[model samples]
Target: MPPSAGVDRAPRAAWQAALRGAVLAVACLASTLAAAEGQPGTSIATSVASRPAPAQAAAQPAAIAQRIMVLERQGRARPQETAAEVDAEITRVAPFSAAHRELLTVQGLMLAEAADGAAAERSALALDDWHLHPGAQEAGLAAGAALLIRATFAAHGGHDLKRADALVQEALGRLPPEVSDLDRYRFVMVHGYIKDRAGQLEEAVRLHHQALALADQLGTPWRRAEARTALAYSYFGARQLERARQLSDEALALASEATDWVGLGRAHNTAGIVLDGLGDQDGQRFHFEQAIACAVRAGSKRDEARYLANMADFYLKKGEFRTALLHAQRALPLARELRDPDSELVALANIGFAHISMQHLPLGKRFVAQAIAIDEDRGALAGAASTWLELGGYLEQAGDLRGAVAAYHKHRKLMAGVLRADEQKAILAMQEQYDAEQRNRSLALPQREQQIKAEQLHRRDLQQLLWALAGGVSLLSFGVIVALLRRVRQANRLLSASNQVLRQHGERDPLTGLANRRAFQDEMKRRAADGMLCGTVYLIDVDHFKQINDHHGHAVGDAVLVEVAQRLRATLREDDLIVRWGGEEFLVLVQAMAGDHVDALAGRMLAALEGTPVAVQSRQVAVTASIGFATFPIGPASLPVPWERAVNLVDTAMYLAKAHGRNRAYGVRLRQAANDESLQAITGALEAAAQDGRVALTLLRTEGQAKPVEVAA
Candidate 1:
């Protein structure tokens, strides 16, 4: 059997290699444990010696606190063992004592770290109960640390990002001004991790930098290693692979020097990811192996499961399906044991991909569906979208066209929701920017008025002075007044021009030079007021746009968008309203065209984009769009649909085109009068509605296809 064989039949050489790697990891863990035994707050023997003879019972609680602190510093590799120790200590201490509360806090942190959410929640509740009791000490660093742990777990689990973010904020507020640098560093790192998970990469990087600075002040190799690893993870998220590699390398070296087993494991894992991104497959594998070894030595089932899953993903990508399945199978049980849904998701996905590649279609699809179910339950929209796309590709490869199309549709729908949320955020940001500019203008107006008054008074004083003086002085003062007047007039003209420019910029997307959503809103409002809202709405989305940006660069992506905008302009009628809807989406409003003309226009738009490759950066890159279109007053009875609802219908249709395949168009039209219930049903389930004869749909493909369209009416 190969090194990647099943758990029971693992190769002897691989075992020996793993054991060799574990030597250093074990030494590091031992050194950390030894150091913990001598720390001021963690020395049980010292604590016991300090207590008076008659107060020996009181000393036992203090001793237990010291022991718990020691176990905490010893690393999280053996959370179960550490937890057992905590449980034993709890029995030794008086119930509800200060020491007992400290033990409860550690227990909560341990459970959360291990991904036991239910038990951790219970522990958090207990802590809350204790805090509410009379004469209980103010919730301090320990409570804050526990909350941070829970917040991190929540964010990583994809359970509730908003709640996790709120919890972190609360935890930060709870931290005392006099908290130690180490404690503050941990809190900052956790906060950064949460922010990164929340898609705030820049903020996460900034927070990680703050943590690094604090670690530098503390001047400990272990802390510095941890900080660098965290910052490296943020850089990885930002897709700065080279910078991440550099930081991860530095972190690894620092951790090795400090004999920090836990930090070493994390650095190794981060390095593996960066290496994989950089296409260093051998380096990636080695790092993952070392990470697993370190995790094993540290007694951390959670880390072990994660590293194994990552290894499985690497093998799966390399086309070693059986090897990948074996690794994933091993990881799945460990993840389940730790109750880590996130790691379980990774394992299941890898296993599914592997099985599908090996021709186990039904079994693979079931596993993939299970993973997606978990993602949906956890509200992990991005994860679900990616998984659906992957499944679609596999289905397509397996010649299951119908299944592939269905999977793609689900992927497109989820991705559309994600994009919509992102668009909303962008709109809010633009609104904020506009509001800020308005505030600046408001503040400047008073100052400008005051300056104008001051200038006028100075002019009057100068005129009086000139009158008091001679003819030459009067002429010079007149010249000065005239020059000042001209300058003021120039300033006013410049200000007006600036305001006009701001308005134009606000209404247009800078990248594509097309009217933006704000302009679209204004046009819609105008149409509504005039009672002339009877246009065909088309929603066009650039296909695989993010991939283009990632593979090429954002600069190239912008060029593509610019080219797309120009192509759209060339394809549509001059009277059509073209707007940069948001992101890689565009909206077009064609003034009341004939029904047949609308369909023809949709086909023309698709041809215009797919006909020629876009010329950008001296390279011809193929660009295509998925288009969805609908004409207003669409039914046989000519029932009017609101412009908003009409646009949404077209948006759904566009996704349908995307689901079917890119470089195509899908248009929706009502065959009968659309009541509210029927419209809702159609919008909610377009394909199903089409199948059941609730609406008519037209799918337009590129020129080379066998048929121009397949109309379901």
Candidate 2:
């Protein structure tokens, strides 16, 4: 029934709390310690300035040190009194002493476990008082240990990859070569981790393999598990789900064998994500449950927060909005407690996304805005980029056009920066590869020198022997060299010609000899990014083209399509751009247009195809086309969107034209004033027509009227 006795009888989290309370009660009361002297935590001073009895100094520290290590093992839920005791012992313990060094490491780890990265950094900084030189036995070990703690804190607690990498590299440089393989494994793991976080997955996999090799060399099961998990994460990012799952299973098995709950939790979480990607709901759920359970058992608040965030994302992906919100809400407090901006960003973004997906626009926007603020403050570029994109979609769907536009702009800006950073990383990788090659070449220089020396010594004899045979072989060698040079030139010429053809093929369709879809999209994307090219897009379909293909065979059908492309191109203005959108379709953009000219142009396009019969295989074939068009800046009051929307609208109109009797145009007019309701109505109509193929199906049975339908202005 006694407090101390109850500690051992309690279970799990309860046992942990009981142990803390019992230890604190004993330390707070001097009489209890006096009654049971030399008990665990009995010798630890309650105040930093308090010194132990000289006779007790030797014995007391040993007991306090052992107790502190026990608390360190128990996780980060220790009471304030327990920390005070450790601090008091820190001051009383001799500087650079074994007890002091051990306490520093434990304190540093404890701060990290609390998700207090800044405090952890400060704890590690206290090691400077030792004044030990780098690579010195105890001093080097202590410094390396501090840096490892600091790196881990930076990585998980703050998501400060740059800081983490620096700390790890510093440790690697300072630690002696004879340092334990376990320490080396930890030191090497940071590079892969940062690369993975930064979206450099291939580089991360390579580094993780290096870490795995070191882990294997050390025969450390836990680190081997961690390295495998890290590699699996990169594979998951690359969407190689089966491989990711296999590696994750291996990692989980190793972690379980080592009783490494943290590793087990991370591996399970990764497995869940991979399973979700594979659409294995039962497998996903199992891993998700296991992950959460392991996170709780591991007692790492940072890991717990991350697991909650991952679950939120999982539910969000599944369209389970309320469940996502619940997990995200639980994560937010822990993220704030940890002061981890990245975690906060994920939690807030998920909450916003769930709300927005559930139609709570205002509430969702507020949460997303808060997340953006944190990301901006922390310089978390990837997080900011993704959140901005989500906000853009949310705002656009909510009909907040201006806000949506602004969010999209921000998203594009961040994406551009991310792309540039990724490109830089790729360039760096290439440079490193080249530098390694150059170094190898430099390494071979000495061997070349030795070879040259041996050759020079034999040169006199060799020159005499060569003089004997030179005259007879000279003509043959010369002829062979000339022949080889000519062959090399011929091959280079052929390769150049081949590459030229390939480049041409990339830009144009071989059959139609028209600009391909990739070329069109590239041009449109460039214009969109530059805030240029706002006009009208015409989507055209040859009426009953499939029937023509079935009746005339594909050869004649291909010829008819080519004729269609030619006729359409002949009618377009020099400034307009046209592309073979797909089979039996053509998309034209009126690059620069005069006021209300697009309507007339559409009419002319329909008339042009009807005016001429295509001559295919020396036979005239009757052909008529239906054209549908949509203009940018949906109405006078609105703004232009990316070319995609314009293309989709036109495509819908084209189908409707095909349905309501071929050879007519249906279009949405520009420069006509319209309210927001009209735009929404048009969008709704397009969506309905698209979803059920109602326009393409029903309108074909319409009354004899062949008039084109007017779209929203």
Q: Give the top-scoring candidate (TM-score).
A: 1
> Each model's TM-score, in the order given?
0.71, 0.52
Candidate 1 lDDT, 1-713, residue by residue in tens:
11112111111101111100111343444455334443333322233334334545544544454455555545256655666666666665556666666677666665665556776677677666655666665356556756876785575443566688889999888877787665677677767766665556666778889999998997867768778887887787666778988999999998898776766887888887666556566887898899888778766666777778777766766678899899889889997987767677777877887888888988988898888887788777867877887777666666666777788678767865765645655755655555444434443255654565565666566556545544455456567756656665665565566556556755777678899877787787788874335888899999877556544554567788999999999988787899998778999998878877988888888888888998876878888999999888777877677665577678778867766667888888787787755675677578877887878898887767434455662
Worst 10 residues of 2 by lDDT: 1-10
Report how far residue 587 has shifted in candidate 2, in Å.
18
Least accurate stretch of 10 residues (summed lDDT) in model 1?
12-21
Q: How accurate is candidate 2 locally (lDDT)?
A: 0.61
Relative to the unseen true structure, what is the C-alpha lDDT of residue 239 in candidate 1, on a scale of 0 to 100? 64
Tens-digit per-residue lDDT, 528-563, candidate 2: 785334877888888766446434544567788888
Over 4 Å off, model 2: 1-115, 129-167, 397-403, 410-713
Candidate of highest lDDT: 1
Clashes counted in candidate 2 amount to 0
